[model samples]
Each structure stands twice: as structure tokens, then as C-alpha cells.
Target: MAEIQTTTLIDDLTGKPLDAEKAHRIHFSVEGKTYRLDVDEKGADEFHAALDRFIEVSTKVAAGGASKRAAAAPRRASAGSGEQTKMREWAKANGYEVAERGRIPAAIQEAYAAAN
Candidate 1:
């Protein structure tokens, strides 16, 4: 059997971090509310699985945020119509929904016409 590492995250009612550890048990009190976490070997395994899921989700969120920030940065002029069509087709095939409107607010139609 593979050895599993466990991690815990304890928070108060206000969502403030109380404690964190890599042990199978945790005890803490917050705002007069006491809490105890005791996990057996099986429970520890499950807890580790949950922690893995959280790490995966957090990584994905951070990556998405970074991607959005990068995309928000200004780029060179828009691509030509042929390139745009190829991009739209690629997006559709990859299960991404492409907006009908162009990136430019005004002169979009004119720009697209000139590109083609």
C-alpha cells in the first residue's frame, strides 16, 4: 500500500484560518467554539483525497485567473477574416463557444470585410 500524507484546514465561523497541519488529528477553538478533528487511517486517506481535490481545483482557478489577466492585456492588430474563421472553427471543434461579434465595438463589420 502506498503511504498517504494528510493535511487539515481549520477555519472559524468567519472563515478565518485557525490552524493547518499535516497530521491525522487537529484541535482548535475559535470564538468560544471548540472543534476537534480525529481521523483514523481510513479517514485520513479520505481526507487526503479531499485535500488533493482542493489542490487541483485551486490550481485550476489560479491558472484560469492568470490566463484571463494575460488575455486582458492589449495585443497587436486583429487577425484577418480567414484566420478568424479558422480560429472560430477551432474553438467550436474544441467545445468552446465563440461570440458572434468581433473584438472591436465599432467598425467590426468593416474590419472583417477588409480582412477577408
Candidate 2:
């Protein structure tokens, strides 16, 4: 005799069964609390798009939870013409993700200072 087993993956937010290939695991943290969600491709895209604004301005965290800004702590931005532009350019060139406009990450400022 032979037996077959099956399992269904459901989208947490939509409560619908997800196709195995379309299933996604999204992980994120908020206020120091970590979370995981199971969703389909569409849900994953929507979730990311909704958070894109905040995510762009936010600092990237290392796997172990330590971030450059948190460690640097309370640094000040230097004043000058096109400082933001220069920082953004440098950041992009150096593979850092920065927003189009907003509070610049202190780490980028520090790196720019050190570089030039």
C-alpha cells in the first residue's frame, strides 16, 4: 500500500491558499520587535511597496541586529551647499540605498566625511 501527504500554505493576511511557487516569507522588524509573514507574490509586493517610503529613509540593520547609526549615536550633519546631493551620490555609488529626500543616515554622512 502507498500513501500520499499534502500540505497547503495560506497567506496570513488574505487567508487564501497560496500556490507553492508563489509563496513568500517576509521578515521585518519594528520598534525592536521582529516578525515573519507568509504571503503570496502579490501580497509580498504590496507589503514592500507600502513600506518603501519608510524603508528608504531607514538604516539597514545587520543580521545580528546592530546598525551603524545606532552604534554611532547622535551625530550632526555638516552644513554646506549640495551636501545632501553629494551624500546621496556617494551613497548610491558605494551601494547604499538612500531615499530621494529625507533625514540622511548618519553613517552616510560619516562615510562621506571620511572619503572626502
Model 1, residue 75: C-alpha shift (Å): 4.1
CA lDDT, candidate 2, residue 43: 90
Worst 10 residues of 1 by lDDT: 11-20
For all the candidates, what are their Cα RMSDs to the real structure?
Answer: 17.4, 19.2
TM-score, per-candidate, Cα-based: 0.24, 0.51
lDDT of 1 by residue, 70-102 (tens): 446666687788767766665556565667656
lDDT of 2 at 59: 87
lDDT of each: 0.53, 0.85
Q: How well does candidate 2 match the true structure in TM-score terms?
A: 0.51
Question: Could you tell me which 10 consecutive residues in candidate 2 have the lowest summed lDDT?
Answer: 66-75
List clashing residue pairs in candidate 1: none
Going through the candidates in the order shown, the clash numbers are 0, 0
Local lDDT at 70 for model 2? 54
> TM-score of model 1 relative to the true fold?
0.24
lDDT of 2 at 17: 93
